[model samples]
Target: MSPADTGASTTVGARLPASPDSPTDSRMAPGGPGYRRMSLALFLAGVATFALLYSTQALLPLISGEFGVAAGEASWTVAAATGGLALFVLPMSALSERYGRRTVMTASLAVAVAVGVLVPFAPSIGALVVLRAVQGAALAGLPASATAYLAEEVRPRALVTAIGLFVAGNSVGGMSGRVITGWVAQEWGWRVAVGVIGALAVACAVAFRLLLPAPRHFTPGSLRPRVLLGTVRDHLANPLLRRLYAIGALFMTVFGGVYTVIGYRLTEQPFGLPQGVVGSIFLVYLVGTVSASTAGRLVGRLGRRGALYLAGGTTAAGLLLSLGDRLALVLLGLVLITAGFFAGHAVASSAVSRTATTGRAQASALYQSAYYVGSSAGSTVGALAFHSGGWAGTVGVGLLAVLGVVGITLCGTRAARVAARREPVPAH
Candidate 1:
């Protein structure tokens, strides 16, 4: 069944009358009371989460010069953050289950923004990486909590659209943070650029808190270690979930590696682009936003595996195109890469949510953890490759990751065919 149809079925079940003591059946839907407020609040939360998370990415070159660090060392600033998020996301999700989604999200944003404010003042690269890691760990509560919140509060029929808006905010935040840092660092410095992003995050956090309605649908979940471990084990044991998780990680590996190294490439040699211009390159993320939103339609046309193949091919093509020295070709390549990465991520993440029947929250958390781990690995590995072998090295890494995605998808296709053959024919 289609993702929306599955959601609709779940919503229909949720709407059925229950005992008076049960949680209220009313849910936020398009045109329903509190819907706009909820959407806007969560959108802002998404903006704050991402803007603060990658605030340093566009400034990596500047950071390298100021700290007297190599490309790989400076990349730790990015990698550390993503690694922290990967390590802490599941624990944060567990906290959300025990406490409350809104509460956890509010606390997460508050701590993350606070850390963001401190980021610009770090005394050294080591301090900066530590602060970024702290900020990332703090922000981990937002993703799974926000998804759970929407699933519980928003009607299933409106779930996909609502989630899409949230994801769009993420894209906007990533693009704007990089662009803003690029120009601002050119004028003021990387410190001030990051400070500006921190301030923006503060504003988003405040707006988010003010606008979000209190949760009426949330029920406290068990925090027992055994239960959590069992849920995690069950999810890990599922081959489909394992494949989806790997696909997500591989897609993000390409995206994270490329973006992390692109600034360095542009600032050097053939391109000789200014910091502001390098930052503006992130505008290609708007293409990702569009591609991600249209993923469902793509799946409708191509089916899941087919859509994955298309995304993989698109990313591979982009990686190859980016090998060229021409500025225009590089920009177009980034556009294609962003589009493919976002679409693949959307498909893989959605598949995770659909695959897990009992532990949807934990399933999503695992996928997210894997996703960020890829980001972390990509940042470190990509930068190291660039340090030794230049832009070609980074592109080579991305291409290999794209190949991994394609390989996994092919395996999924073969498994599906095998499973189909194993099924008995329908009775006459």
Candidate 2:
């Protein structure tokens, strides 16, 4: 049932109903006060969540020096957080279903910031990894809840734009965080760099709490293990959603692989860029910001499948370009790849909400679970590949991963139809 059907009231900052008959009433209207508040808050959530989650990325080299580990092992500092997030995303989603989206998300930011603040202070590499892992687990609360909240509150027509903007916030946060941390680490130390990021995250979290409207559509649900399992099975059984899950995993695998090792590459030999300059490479993420923010219009014009194809192709093209020796070509390649990732992710993730008929939060949680698992696996494996064979091998793996996304998107759709035709009809 709709929120209106449940006779629920919105928080103070929410939009009024457009009328019972209008589709707009079923959603937060495109230009309403609630819509603005929701967008702003989620944008901040995206920034704070990702910024804190990935703050260690640009500092991996410094971390390697400080902790005296190989590049692959040092990369784990980034991997542990993602691994923890992957492990706990579903449970956090279940918690959101039991409590409320806003409450859960607000608390997530607060706790993650606390952890981020402590990460730079760990006495041992083992302790640092452990702290990062816990921080990752705490951070999982935002993605599932935020996606579910967008699905629940925003109108269908506005969903793509809303998701796009949210992703743009992610891109901007990632870029800014890396640049800030790298520059600061170059001048003073990695500890101060991370500490600054933690401070920014705290500020964003506070603003998020103040700007976010309370859930008008939330209906609390049982937290039974059986119910959670049933929801997972249902999402996995849906052909389109299943394909989307694959796409999410594959996309992040390639993305994580590329970014995880690129830092190591730029800091060595021919290019020999400084840590600060290497972090500047993330400035390419600005392209991602634009692409993500524009993805809604792209989907509108090309349809979801078409947009997915474009994104995959763009990423593949970028990976091929990155194989070059010239710095210009390499930077250009990074730009294309980053832009493709954000655009593709925005469309694909939003599609989950559009496709699910029930258990929207669970469905979103599953998607995020796939995404983070891909991140965890990709970071570890991608780094290993780079360690074994250098940039060529890394790009090769990334290209193959993108091809996998394309194949699944095209073939999976047809396979789903054929399977549907073979299902036996149930008698009434």
Candidate 3:
């Protein structure tokens, strides 16, 4: 069955129901004391997580120039960080389950920011990549823990708005980080640019610690291998969930590849844009923020499969448009690509939540893993494609990934139809 037909709650920003041990009155609500603090704390945490995670992306060309490395080799700085996050996120989530979300998030931010501080000081390309990988692994705790914390501590009625604020922070962080780094790196060099981001992350982390209210309704979960493995196996076994996971991965592959290589494309040949101008181009990410927020409405109007198709088509068109030499066309293409990717991601991820009947956290974690793995792959492969075949090669990779999304969505539509036909007839 399609995700909308699953009879599951599909609100993208909504959390799981509160635990029975936690009374509704005890949870934070919209107007309750500490609500704003809790919201701001998590918001800052989100900012720190993403801003630090992607700080090097806008500086890839500079990194390449500094180290005399190829684009594909420099891309590892981005790939290694995402790969580390993918590898460690599950284990970190398990830790949060046992230790508590607030503790895990606080510790994660502390470590990630510490690593961020050291990143600007790396003397070699290898050292920088290693530091970034460590920083990514350290940041893994924030995503799942922040969501779980909200589920446990915030009222169900106010959950969506609270989570929305945190997500907004992520968008702002990503855009501002790239933009800030672009201009900063232009004047002060990439090292100082990264150092500025590190300092910003430190401020965010400190405010997160001070402003976040203590969790009043946390219940510790088990850490047994057998239990966790069994849950993961069950999630992987579900066909619908499997498809949603693949969809998420494919969408991210397109996004990761395009953004990773765009810097090189704009800085070379006919475009020859300045570092700050190239960085400002990432303001297209703001389109993603809007598109992702409207995904629920799009799904409501178009159904899940229809929304996927539209997103794919939009992405493919963007890829084609971006092949031109005109700078305006390239910028417009980027905006379209950003919008399509974020909308598709929002739909697929929400579908994963709706499809899983139990072990929802594990289900989401698996999706997160696939998503970041795709990011790492895209960063590495996209740069390789660009190195070999220029802008067209990078666009080729994205188009193929978008095709994968469409093909998978088609399979889902077929499966839903087959399932519908097999249902038993009701008494007339």
Error of 1 at 407 (Å): 1.3
Give the worst 10-residue stretch by lDDT in candidate 1.
Answer: 12-21
lDDT per residue, candidate 2, 75-161, as tens digits?
Answer: 888889998988888999999988989989998888999888788898878998899999999999999889888876876667778
Error of 1 at 97 (Å): 1.0
Q: Best candidate per lDDT, number?
A: 2
Which candidate order results from sorting by TM-score in descending order? 1, 2, 3
Q: How accurate locally, in lDDT, is each candidate? A: 0.85, 0.85, 0.82
Model 1 TM-score, 2 decimals: 0.92
Look at candidate 3 and tell me the lDDT of residue 417.
94
Clashing pairs in 2: none
What is candidate 3's lDDT per residue for 199-257, written digit by digit as tens? 99999999999999987766666799998898789888888889988987888898889
Task: State the local distance difference test value for candidate 2.
Answer: 0.85
Off by over 4 Å in 2: 1-26, 415-428
Name model 3 segments beyond 4 Å from true: 1-40, 150-167, 210-218
